[model samples]
Target: MTTAIAGRIEIVSDAICPWCWIGKAHLDGALELLAAEGLAFGLGWLPFQLNPDMPEGGVDRRAYRTEKFGSWERSQQMDAQVADAGRVAGVEFRHDRMARTPNTVEAHRLIRLAGVDGVQHATMDRVFRAYFNEGQDIGDRAVLGALGREAGMAAPTLEAFAAGDAARAEVVAESRALAQAGINGVPSVLLDRHLLFSGAMPAERMADGIRRAVAILRDRAA
Candidate 1:
């Protein structure tokens, strides 16, 4: 049997993190670019809650950002930066439609459970779009269930799973462990658990990292 490269790409991010969304787009583009170069690798999503302490009902986004960034003006600047990047990634970020800053624990939980059905990417993409584009509340069970359906998951099963606390603890624990590992930002890319760079990186940079990772795996296999 021919040996294949044995490494996976893990993207550590939160749904509400605009940069992560943009970074994911870049990652997708990078992966496609590498695929054209005859490199294909597995992709995984590692959960990270942007607001672990958010209220169950979430907080007013305007108030949250104004306070978190120390001023609304500064928050606008950050949003504008992301908006510019989003344009490059083809993601039209609807910050104006965003009302609440949700506790993304449930959203992460949805991704975790979605992984079991082998639609993790589709499910995660839907969640990101629902929040960042459609301005939908992803923290809600109904919304998550609907997204699961969109991702080809069985509706009743997804509903039951989302309505319960399955995978919630594991998601939180994994995110906590990731923080303990000294990574404090979203859009962090890892090749076989080896940290590459944090935040949204350029597509060429991601492709280079993937290419290098594949080379290392091939050497080890040989």
Candidate 2:
């Protein structure tokens, strides 16, 4: 039996979304499983912002939670569930350690820069860890510089980019386009720019979706 092949999977997600983190973990596991089975697929990451108008300095996590979710108790409940799910995905989510959630426009800008260097995935991973695990304010130029450095980007270049308004408009335009597409949330997976899979799905399910997508592409080619 021959294994199916598919076009690249485009993942639209925000760095601040815990579910997006879990979704990425699940996708990683799925890709590993596929690779072990000798299957192949390509991956791309797109930008999405949960809070587009967030200030550069950022807002306290607790305060943001209260404002967004109504109460601390409600927020904690959701956090606990996300934490448990992250652990299952082999991610150490240190929610309590997070101090603030900043506007991620600059972070997204860095991701775009990473794409030029072919290190977008690495930069995104570092940003997620820095924000959710290490409690770093991702909006800060210094912190972004460090993360960019970890992603193999030159510090001076990253600092200069972060200090300027580069890619800010592009980020906003992308966010607007996503909204127009009716994507109100993160972790949305698009296959072949048509089939849309929203939310964090299990690895097996995601792989199954990939297989299906591949089948569709094959049929189209035929």
Candidate 3:
């Protein structure tokens, strides 16, 4: 009988990044496939804000992209690619419905809270679904509160947590740490704190990467 190997996979990303959504979908597919194949792995989500200093009320997506990337054409092209990738992964990403790109500090904080609650995966999925599928303003307290409730988080607790600066400092600190670690982009997947896989890779490739990482961990344990 083959012994199950445990591995840690951390994904550093922002909620507003289209590529990050695609990468997440790919990772989800890979994990599901691996599980069906009897492979074992643990996943974690880390904070990385694409727009760390975005305005409190957020900025129009078109204006933000044009200013940051210098061209609407470039942004549209990238979005098209991301949409295609998401579709391939069985996710319906409604890019047209996304109006604004807000500072993801609060969203990251919620992820931190979810981690403490041991429901990080569910919370992250709710955030992604709210932003990408339902066209909800993830930066708003009401939307986040609903998302938290959906993820089985207590409403009052999450409300107080969001109202305060809880985990805000930690989220920002983690983002800074990721940047200092040479990750200047979203959708960076780190395996075992050593191997780095960037961008939205195919599900099969990610599964292979996870398998190799698990093997290394097993060997190290032995």
Candidate 4:
């Protein structure tokens, strides 16, 4: 007989959100710790757009962030803060290399497709790395298609999927619905479909939360 898995770990996040990437890293660490305790889980990534109203093709990162955050200096300050946190989490955030602040809906669509292909986590990681580390224009179809292929997806299949409106509306609608549900933030971690917490948490805190959630699930099963 097979042993029961602990539960599902789903992270609702946007591709370009730096904190979301940090949150994912922390969760990865938490999972490693949980594994030592004999807990196992199914992991999934869900779509959320940080800039849902961002225009197609995206815009210059410095200009967009400067306007959004009130000033260029302020934007840089925020980036510095994130970068410091990232170093602690073992993520190297290369904000200086980023030129475009992408409209992440297309990236989210690719993530949805990756889920169907059973390569969602790998695809999501590549997306995050491409955007945050390498400063790739992930808003572009060609770029996203390339990343998908790199993540074990067939070229023709992902290219066609990227060119079409297959997961477009679903991605947009789900993001909007999640926003309406008061999840006004990215990096929202959910256990068994219920929210565990929001924002980038340390690995130990996240692990403790997962432990409590698993205990609750086990009690229910009992």
When 1 and 2 are scored with lDDT, the better candidate is 1
For model 1, what is the error of residue 19's alpha carbon versus the real structure, in angstroms, after optimal superposition?
Answer: 0.6
Poorly placed runs, candidate 2 (over 4 Å): 1-5, 154-160
lDDT of 2 by residue, 24-115 (tens): 88988887777666676666678898887888788998998998999999999999999999888878889888988888887888877777
Which of the numbered candidates is closest to the native, going by highest TM-score? 4
* Model 2 CA lDDT for position 158: 80
Candidate 4 residue-wise lDDT, 1-222, digit = tens: 334578898999999899998998898999988888888889898788888889998999999989899999999999999999999889899998999998888898888888877888899999999998998999998898989999987666696676687789999999988888988888999998989899899999999999998898779989
* lDDT digits (tens) for residues 1-222 of candidate 1: 333444788899998889988998899999878877766677789998767888987888999899989999999999888899899887899888888888888888888888777888888898899999899988788888888888887665687575688887899999999999987999898888989788777888888877887788678779
List the candidate numbers ranked by TM-score, top first. Answer: 4, 1, 2, 3
lDDT agreement of model 2 with the native = 0.81
For candidate 1, which ten residues in a row score worst on lDDT?
A: 1-10
In terms of lDDT, the best-performing candidate is 4
Give per-model TM-scores.
Answer: 0.93, 0.91, 0.90, 0.95
The all-Cα superposition gives candidate 2 an RMSD in Å to the true structure of 2.3
Q: Is candidate 1 or candidate 3 better by lDDT?
A: 1
lDDT winner between 1 and 4, please give it.
4
> Candidate 1: which pairs clash?
none
